[model samples]
Target: MTKVSTVTIGALALTASALAQTSIAQAQSTEHNTAEKDYRVFEKTFGATKGKRRNHTKGFCFVGEFAPVDNAILAYSNSPIFSSTSEVNGRVSHKGGKNLSPDDKFGDRGLAFEITTPDGDYHIINVNTEDFFPASKPADFIDLVRALGEGGEAVKALAAGRPELQAYLAHHKKNRDTTLRPYEGTQFNSVNAFYLVNESGDRTAIRWSMVPSGSQGIVVETNSDFLMDNMNANLTNGTVSWDMVVTIANDNDDPNNAAIRWEGEHTRITATRLTVTSTSTEADGECDAVNFDPTVLSDGFVVTDDPILEARSQIYAHGIGVRLSEKE
Candidate 1:
């Protein structure tokens, strides 16, 4: 074909592609979007970064152990994990889609642990905040991310309409101010609720938090990966640990809305102590092969009615497949 004819054909192809893209975007329904939609939005916002989890892209894995603080937890959940110390894969990360993301940003922080128990493997991916994402449902969360990505007035407008989102952002900002080093006593919460099934076939609605032994404020800020720096240094000296404190939901508490924090005083129990003895880079660690699938619960805990909690499995699956398959 002549150069002019080839150029004309390429231009037409580009126009068709643009139209198709617009059509796809316009065809989407905001209210009824599914896990697949959430995955697509995530991929579009960030990318299929090689060898990294699509979200919580930046991480450090640590081989550790999770031991129950005491057998008092057995009253709530009669699982073997609560009865004996078990091996664990602990991962800490800055919540985002970019690998090697700087630790200086005021983003949500993630702390995940995969505990291999005698019964089965149990995974819990918690966050630094006391509450979950601003969006309650899966689709709304996708919308929140899209709006935040747009920045400027879009964030303001969305938060203005949703009080929960406003409260979440406010809490995130407050924690970001107080949180310094990752392993230096940074508190992480399992914002989603779960039901702890006891031996009597009774289930207790509960939420858990990893309260650090101690916390450090920012001593000095520089263009450095101080998050991991502090974590590694802490590990070299000795093991770092957190007390997993589970909070019971009151009779009036609403477990349906994961986004809403249960107000008023409640019963809290120190269930497990997770100790990190060693660390490795995300790509070089055993955690790279493990998906910290939060939905995978043993006989101890059953899934809650929270829509966001129900939605995590598929989103996580999509992420692991994409990141691991992408050529380095």
Candidate 2:
């Protein structure tokens, strides 16, 4: 009797283990399928631009006429992407011995988008260089607007439109500001920013500002620990957010010109809570310390104090070699 009981118990345990393994496998398969779908969707929507620069991640923006409703913009993105400008003031401003015509030169720094629905009017402002607000060509803009109006089928169809999305999904690269060097506004307001600096030491700046959906601009704080804690939570919890970007055209007014176009925004994080980290290795141990600006080491073992460099070092040293455990 005792022998029979032991055999039966072992059989049950084995069955349970098999079932658990199957469940895990099924879950992984489901995730893979979902990722594939997202990939295909992304590629179809963004299209193929030969020289298109990647947006924050890999999205583009456009101009379109949309109506306000409880489900307008959200509904629009579900459908398609298709897609600016401004005013002047009285202060006499002059630069380079040129009398500045404020009306023609200075307009509202951002574009205002209005969508009216039964609930009320929804207004969204897009800062030119903001990652969240990507712009698209004129014709694409109209298609996106039409898709939103059509709804349901239009949205789903748009989602399934791309082939390159698979490549994006395969890489699974997280989009972070990877601008080289420190400029006026690299870190600011709990968000990341960047600007393109030419050999002449002049830069075209762009800032990435993130705030809750219903909230105004990013709440600049003076504490790093507090801000980091909140940011992680906000992102994990899916708190609605938007990015503010500013683009600058240096010595040029025409939008079609690429050489003059650059990202420009000032002040990344307020000075109070800013901290920069870099890696250095001595014969004895590895050290990570705060830095004022970027620094690089080609010999012995030291790393540039820039965030991009830090990320790369961590990846190469810890991730590739399995030298350290992953940390949040």
Candidate 3:
């Protein structure tokens, strides 16, 4: 009788453990599904631009220098990324898969840069908007992308019940007309939040923005390669610049949900300045050799729990894999 009881109890325990493992596997599968679906949908919607970045394929590389504002940023983090100064390998691109995307149209723009320091390299990519797409999760963003295939107006439907989406669309809609071209009044936002650990190990949640130094320039619709032309012309005259403004999040802020912008007044710090001195028309420039993966950070910089940010690292890895294979 005692032997029979022991055998039965052991069987029940094994079954329970199997059930727990199955639950964990299911959760992980869901996360992967969201990320994989995002990549597949992007391919379906935008098509493939072989040997180029899956998105933001249309861009010109440039070399520049970045330095923290007189070592003022050290109070927040001692990361080498914000140390004295670093060489910048940056790319300015239209936010789309079309390699020949024109500059005259109203679309999202991107500025991705790799900062090479003495210790290591760090990267940052920001969109030319105040906040990112108001998608709470990877799945929600994929749905928006699929909806986008239907048309721009169709995307508005997703905003109907969600005030957050509505406000986001409303903000962009108003800003679209006055939208600054790549080097103009464009203020590139980090969108996702990150935690910065100082020497003492105190963590501060923040989002950074690259704001053009001068007043917002007026929009001038020009030819397809006009923006690049303008950048070259501007460089001939003088270097372009932007202020690195970091916004500190309050305790009530949600570092996990980028879909919702942090509302109300908050502390803003001018971390540093970026100066672009030279432009490159070459397809295979310094920026191409390196993947500007934002998650790839130096010490003192830590990623947040934002699911969209996490998904980006995976999605970008898939992108680089396909591009590198094309080269081979």
Encode model 3's per-residue lDDT on 171-204: one tens digit a residue.
7777655543655457788888889889999889
lDDT of 2 by residue, 31-111 (tens): 434433332333344332222211111111112233112222221122111111111000101111111212222211122
Error of 2 at 239 (Å): 22
- C-alpha lDDT of residue 215 in model 3: 33
Candidate of highest lDDT? 3
Error of 3 at 284 (Å): 4.0
Residue 21 alpha-carbon offset, candidate 2, angstroms: 72
Note the clash tally of each candidate: 0, 34, 0
Give lDDT: candidate 1, residue 256: 73
TM-scores vs. true structure, each candidate: 0.83, 0.20, 0.83
Q: State the C-alpha lDDT per candidate.
A: 0.70, 0.25, 0.71
- Look at candidate 1 and give me any clashing residue pairs: none
Error of 3 at 316 (Å): 0.3
Candidate 2 — which residues are off by over 4 angstroms? 1-136, 163-201, 210-268, 271-328
- Judged by whole-model lDDT over C-alpha atoms, candidate 2 comes out at 0.25
